[model samples]
Target chain A: MSRITECFNNLKSQGRKALIPYVTAGDPDPKITLPLMHALVESGADIIELGIPFSDPMADGPVIQLACERALLHGTRLVDVLDMVAEFRKTNQTTPVVLMGYLNPIEIMGYSAFADKAKAVGLDGVLTVDLPPEEAGEFNRLMKASDIDVIYLLAPTTEEARVQKICAAGSGYVYYVSVKGVTGSASLNVAEVAEKLKMIRKYTEMPVGVGFGIRDDASARAVSEVADGVIVGSVLVNKIAELTGNQEQIPEAVAAITASMRQAMDK
Target chain B: MPTKEDLAIAKQMPDAGGHFGQFGGRYVSETLMAALQQLEQTYEKLWRDPQFQAEFDYDLAHYVGRPSPLYHAERLSRELGGAQIYLKREDLNHTGAHKVNNTIGQALLAKFTGKPRVSAETGAGQHGVATATVAARLGLECTVYMGEDDIRRQALNVYRMKLLGAEVVSVTSGTRTLKDAMNEAMRDWVTNVDNTFYIIGTAAGPHPYPKLVRDFQSIIGREARQQCLAQTGKLPDALVACVGGGSNAIGLFHPFIEDADVRMIGVEAGGYGIETGQHAAPLSSHCKPGVLHGNRTCLMSDEGGQVIGTHSVSAGLDYPGVGPEHSYLQEIGRAEYTAINDDEALHAFRHLTLTEGIMPALESSHAVAEAMKMAPTMDKDQIILVNLSGRGDKDIHTVAGIDGINF
Candidate 1:
């Protein structure tokens, strides 16, 4: 079984929703990111999504976009991101690390090279926001060959046929964008998300991870009831931004949010 | 010397590995390779389909106001010199720009493909308005991603799109401009490829889009050729059009590309100058042969391949890249390109408004400026046909604000 699948099954067996904390890799600082990743896992993160900084991140909200800009200002690239992941794997290998970002950097690097490098570095999956299932054939094939899952996102606007296509192409838990807008636009309609999740469940047995605007504990808990995983991104990135100039406070903020979210889900 | 038949054969032949001369070829992620191949095949099949052609022709004629007038700018021509200058009035088309001509065709194609929603990125809101106009007409859900800055500056157009029932998404990432909007649109297309159709506004992007958009837009050149022949008894001495992503220019230039007697000039936006790093003249300055947004074209990039920002008084022309076919035309010496700074374009904007009583878009003003410069140099009997790609209604506020006046 894939590590993501294993993680999902373990969480299911324990009757717990997966706590996925998204952090921009090399944000705050590269020296601090790996430690933060470890800290996130210790703070009850079931899965960790490492956002690779991109020059033009279109799907991201302002918070994550600013985080990406800060990371790139420090000269962060795909190689630097993978090296961090590889280093993180030295001590913690069980947590599934999904590299999420746009497709340009990976395209520039070549898919086969990226797949091999990612697998070698203990990365389990990739979530390319801009690569739909219809276009992801070659990338998915290469990653599948290297035992790297290609996670796909299904938006609220996605139709039944598209959901089926995404389910067939994807291996790890499918990410469901809760809103029609960019990452941190507004609060999501929990009932609407639930309806979409119910529709998604009809097509795929793979766990669905709901994200995009699930900021607070209430929203997270609302999503956790229906989704197998609740992916928190903009909120965490915003927390990092608030602690910018003061590096010592990042962990406390991240831990506090993660704990709050974990407690909400457990309720 | 090549025979007519031989030239036709050459035109039909896909350049070494499916390029349009040196301009077009697939430079995309391996993830997109299969879909692009499929799209290329589908486009080829549709290109030969009689039904598709008939429908496209019908829409171009009725919906988009085909055979848009070829009006002689008598006053402006006389002012520039004794040279006779004509304007191919693409602005008179429905939705007030040449962008509608291509969008109408692509929206029909989207319907044929069974796509429920149409997605696109717009720079000046002209393309967005055009796309929204067609989506409303065709009953397809339309989503147009635009730069956040553009959304604020082009508020009237934003409202126009909203009124047309199309969602205008503000893309705040990456310089908050045309290139970023294009990036967002591409991401949306990638994310929704199964059920969405991307109606690209320019003759750029991947192979099939460049070819498809040009084919649709070529109506401008084709109509101008017939109109010129009927009116002047021969083709004009020169064809002048502005190059944003080179859509309007390519549309006017394609039919006359083989006419040896007719010279072609592509005017680029020079915001200040090439040296100031505040210009959108990618073809004239700050660009090298590179792959960006799925097309191997002239792009403004740093040494490390990071795409750079471009500036122009014209929001539509503020792009860091030019179309691949324009690059090829420049390389093969079939066309000449020149830069027109903001001041020159503004002068032409005012000149056209006062002299011709036709306010052209800042993008179209670049071509008008080039025509103003070229007319004086030409012989008294020489005629210049300029593709007035869009009306200046969207630019009035900006022009007024810049001059510290209001209309």
Candidate 2:
């Protein structure tokens, strides 16, 4: 089984929801990423989603978009992101690390090359924001061949027919975008998300992790109740942006939010 | 006689899945897939409906003042001293451009679908004014996303959109140009997919958009085809149009796709020059294929497939990618693409105004410049039909700024 599946299984056995925190690799600077990854694991993160920054992040809101801008300023490339993941793997092995971003960088590196490099780095899974299942057949096959989970996103606007299609295409877990807007755009209603998750459950047995608009501990805990995992992004990236000048405090500052959310979910 | 393959190439494009021979497909986020699918279904049903066709045609005739004249520019033709030049006066449309044709069609789609709001992205402000005009006509709320740089260059059109009661959003993201504006528009559509209908101004973007916008804008070709036959007793030797996102070019080329003898030429913006790498001539420069703004096409991207900034004297043409259909056509050798630098396009802008007393838009000026170059090398008996896609009024400020004039 993939590390992602194993991680989810272990969490299920422990009766605890997965706390996933996403941070852009090479944000503020490249050197801050390793410490941040270690900090996230220490803060009780079950899965760590590392972002590969692209020039244009169309689906992201201002927070994550600025994070991309910061990462790109440090001249972060797709290869650099993989190196960060490999470095993270050197010290930690249990915490599943997923690379999430847009598709252009992977396309530039060629799908086969990207899949091979990702496998070599021991990356757990991938979640390309703009790559829908309709265009992900070959990409998914390539990742699956390398024993990497190809994660997909389900949105509130997704119909039931597509929900089944996406679930079948995806592995590891399904990322359910809790709102209709881009990342960090609007607040999500837990009741609405619960209803959507129920609809998603009818199609597949895969764990559904709810993301988008999960900012504070309250939203994270609320989502954790309905979802198998609470995926938080913008708020964590915002922390990095806040500590741009004082790069030393970024890891601790961001981990504090994750720790609080983890504590809230455990309660 | 055209071969079966040639005819097939023209008719069977952008297959049901929206792939224009591996060039165009929906590469948007999962949040937008269902909305795109819904849009595709609605567009397919309405496109074949006779009532919808009649209503669209009626609006084209009455509101937009269709059948824009195909005038033989005898003076300019004589000046060029080779092929007789004809101008398809799309500049004479209600909004002073070819963009209104597609906007009117999309606006009706929004009305039929009961969408209360319409969102659009514009580069040159021609599409913004056109979209705002249609939205005002239908009492729908309209929002147009434009790059901050474009707002500065085309202030008059921005004011025109505001006068039409449309909210103009200044996009200040990466490279703040047409590409960024499109990204912002896509973001808006993803957020408000339920009640909002995004009226894409060009024959670019993902699936139904390119096909539907092409269908709507093809009126230009249909009219010009009949007009040329009626006036000259034969089809023109060449058809030229400026390709920003390729809406105007596709609009004028779709009807003539099967005319194997008629040369279709698309002019891309060569900002400084192609050799300088400061241009937006992706097809002309032979850039690699990459996905952008929901479609795969030739793009001005770095080695990492990150889209780089594109430069052009014409705001409409300052885009990183061309329409996927254009890419497909280029690959199959059905059409050819070339570039015209800023100075050359400006020369054409002045030359045409002096010779014919008609001011062409800077985007259209690229086509005018290419047509001038081609016209001089062809026989006088041959005809070159250039799509005068828009009027030059909006570009006066840009041109004046270039001339070191403030006003």
Candidate 3:
């Protein structure tokens, strides 16, 4: 079983919900990112998702977009993200780190090279926002060969036929988008997401992580009730944006949100 | 020298690795790496599929009004000496440009793949309009990304697209033009890969798109060949076409690339001059071989790979890159490329409007300028065919202001 699957199984065995904290790698600074990754794990983050900053991030909400813009302005590329992960692996290797972002940067670096590099750098999985299940052959092959999981996204608009294809292509876990529009849009229907999750369960045995608008503890707790994992992106990116260039506030902000999410999911 | 029979033989053979000589290949993102390969393999399989060919050919002929008129420019020819100029009138196409020929075919392929929506980027708004028109016809939702500047300059087209039921998105990032619009469209394709089909406008982009779009647009040359022979009893001495992303040029040139006696000329937009640092002449300026928006082709950039700004009276030809096929033709010495300055294009734009009573698009006027140059040097009996890529109706206001003409 994959680390992500194993972690979720452990959570399920303990009757606990998973807390997945997302952070844009190299946001603010790379120096602080490694430590922040450790802090998230210490503060009760069940899984860590490191967003690889891309020049054009269309799937991102405004908060994460700003964080990406800030990271890109400071010269963050896929190589930089991989380097950070490699460094983090030296001290901490058990926590699963999934790289989430657009495909261009990875395209700039060839797929085989990227897959190999990702594995060498201790990446557990990859969730390319743009590559759908039908188009994930070579990427999935390379990831599987390198012992890395290839995650797929299940959207509200996804059809039943497509769910089978996505499940067949997917590994680690399926990311279930809670809304129809870009990130940060406030039109998520939790009941609709729960219904989609129930539908998804019929298609795949993989864990389902619901994200896109899980902004606070209440929302996270609400999603965690049905989902195997509650994935929070915009909220964490917002905290990073606020703490940028101010190192002292990074840990405090990240810890408070992580603790709150942990408590909310546990209850 | 290949005879018409020999040319037909060459066309029968699929390009090696789906390239027209050295022009096309899969130069794209790792995320799309698998998708493009799958598409390429599928295209190869379906290229001979009777069902796919029948559907594509039927749409081209019945829907797009294929075999666009081969009109003799008698008046314009009389004024430019006795040299007869014939226009393969692609402007008469359904969406008022040759772009529709490709979009319709690609949209069909998108349907075949079961994609839900079609997405594209536009500059002159011709391609966007074409994609929008086809998407509506095929019952697919269309989203067109355009540069904010182009949205303002080509307002009429913007309205036309909206009227056609496409969601017209004005891209506000990057250089705010065609190239930037292309970047945004690629981003959207990456994000919505599950349900979206990226209908690229030109014979550019990465591997399969340039080759696929060129083949779709090749109906122009295929029909023009039969019509030219039927009308004039022979092929012309020269083929001239404008090269923005070089779709129209390649469409016209591909059918005649091996016809050793037929000369091919591609006109680039020379905003000022090649040395003025303000032109879109990618072949003549500081362009090197690099990959952008999926294709390996000539790109105008500085030492640091930052795309430089380009200037042109025509928004469509203002792109900083040329089609990969054009780059290949240049390297192999099969075609000659020249530049038409803004002043010369403006002059030709008015001249065609006044002399021929056919208002050509400013992008097409670049070919008009080159035809004018070639006319004077050729013998009176020598014939030339110009791919009238699009109608000038979209460029009237810009031309009027540039020429200082009241009407």
Candidate 4:
């Protein structure tokens, strides 16, 4: 089975939701990302969403965007991100790592080559922010061939027909953007997310991961009640941003926040 | 790899999936895909619907001013002692530019789709001013996103948009230029999909946009085609237009795609020069296809795939990416794209002011410069028709500042 599928199944038997913490692969520096991934797994993260630093992150708000800028400053390329994932895989084989990014970098590297290298590097899946299913035919084919889950996002504005189409096209899980705005912009309205989740569930049996506004444990717990998984990004990325200047404080700072959300979800 | 069959259909482009010969596709987040699909559907319908066509025609004729004159530049032609040159006066349109043509069409779409608030991203604020003008006319609320740097450079147009009651938000993202403003606007559209309509200034972005903007702006070529036939008794031997995001150039070229007898050329902003590596001529110099914004197209980027900053005296043509259709056109050799340096463009800007008493927008001056160069090499009986896409009034400040003048 795919790592994303197996991870969700393991969490399902535990009567708990998946805690997926996102950190850019080379945020503060390349040397630090390996320790950060291990720390996330220690903090009860079921999966790690590694951001491949892109120049223009359109779906992201300022925090994650700045995180990308920081990573790019150190000359983090796609190969560098793949190497980080490979290094993290040595110690922690159970935790799935999903590379999250825009399409251009992968397009630059060629999609087939990216998929092959990602699978070889122990990356479980990918979530390209800008590539919807309509543009994902070749990308989906190549990733599927490589046994990697090709994830897609559904938004609050997504219609029923498109949700059905996206769910059918995607694998492992469908990320539900809980708010109308970009990442890190606002807080989630749990009731509205619950309502949207009910409609989304009608489309597919794949686990639905709610993100885009799940900042703290309270919001994570609230969304975990209705969602199959709770993905926390910008808020944790904001922590990384706060510690970007300091070299040593990043992993602990990021893990401490992830642990809090983990504790909240477990409780 | 693009198939030979795919290249054959640049004329009947976008194929249902929005691929212009493997270049254009709706490469946006899922949040915007539904909107793009809806837009494509709406456009496919309204573009054929007689009632919608009548409404658009009415607005063009009465509100925005249609059939802008195609005047023969007699004095400029004689001075060069070469091909006769004609100018399609898109400058005479409402809002003092060709931008209003697309804005009026998109504003009507917004009205049809029941979107009460419209948003746009601008470089020089001409598109912002044009969009604000349309929103005011249609009683819709409008907001414009512009880069902080551009908001300062194009300060007069900033004031003009505000005077039109647009809320101009200054974007401070990545390099703070037109590309950044577009990224911010796309984010806003993804967030506010229900009520807000994004009126993209250029014919770039994802699907249906290049096609939609071209369909609307093709009035320039359609009129020029008939006007040329009526005046000179044959289609012009060549067509020239400046390309930033290629809306004006495409609008002027789409109707003539089948006219093998008529040659087409697109001029890109060369900034300093192509050799200096400070220009915006993606197709002419640094032509490599990559995805930026929402479509696969020729882009200006570093080796790491990060879009780099571009420079041009004309703010509108200073973007790093061109329309995807332009990429397809370049690949298929249906049209030729070249570059004009900042000095060459500025020289044409002055030369036109002296010879024709018409001040060309710096964005349009690229076309003027190229046309002058090509005109001198062709027979005097041959003709070149240039899409004078806008007036130069908004650019006077930048030109004067360069010339060490206060105003």
Clashes of each: 0, 0, 5, 0
lDDT winner: 2
Tens-place lDDT per residue, model 1, B170-211, is 987878999999978876765566678889999998778888
Leading candidate by TM-score:
2
Off by over 4 Å in 4: B1-8
Query: Between the candidate structures 1 and 4, which one is better when assessed by TM-score?
Result: 4
- Tens-place lDDT per residue, model 2, A1-267, is 889989989999999999999998889899999999999999999999999998889899989888988988888999999999899899888889999998888888889999999999999899998888888888989999998899999999888988999899999999999999999999999999999999999999999999999989999999989999999999999889989999999999999999999999999
Q: Which candidate would rank higher by lDDT, 3 or 4?
A: 4
Model 1, CA-based lDDT: 0.84
lDDT of 3: 0.81
CAPRI band for model 3: incorrect
Q: Model 3 Cα displacement at A88 (Å)? A: 3.0
lDDT for B62 in candidate 4 is: 95
TM-score of chain B of 4: 0.97
Q: Which ten contiguous residues of candidate 1 chain A have the minimum total lDDT?
A: A128-137
Superposed Cα deviation of residue A13, candidate 3 (Å): 4.3
lDDT of 4 by residue, B54-98 (tens): 999999999988989999999999989999999999999989889
Fraction of true interface contacts that also occur in model 2: 0.76
Residue-level lDDT for B311 in candidate 2 = 95
lDDT score of residue B12 within candidate 2: 74
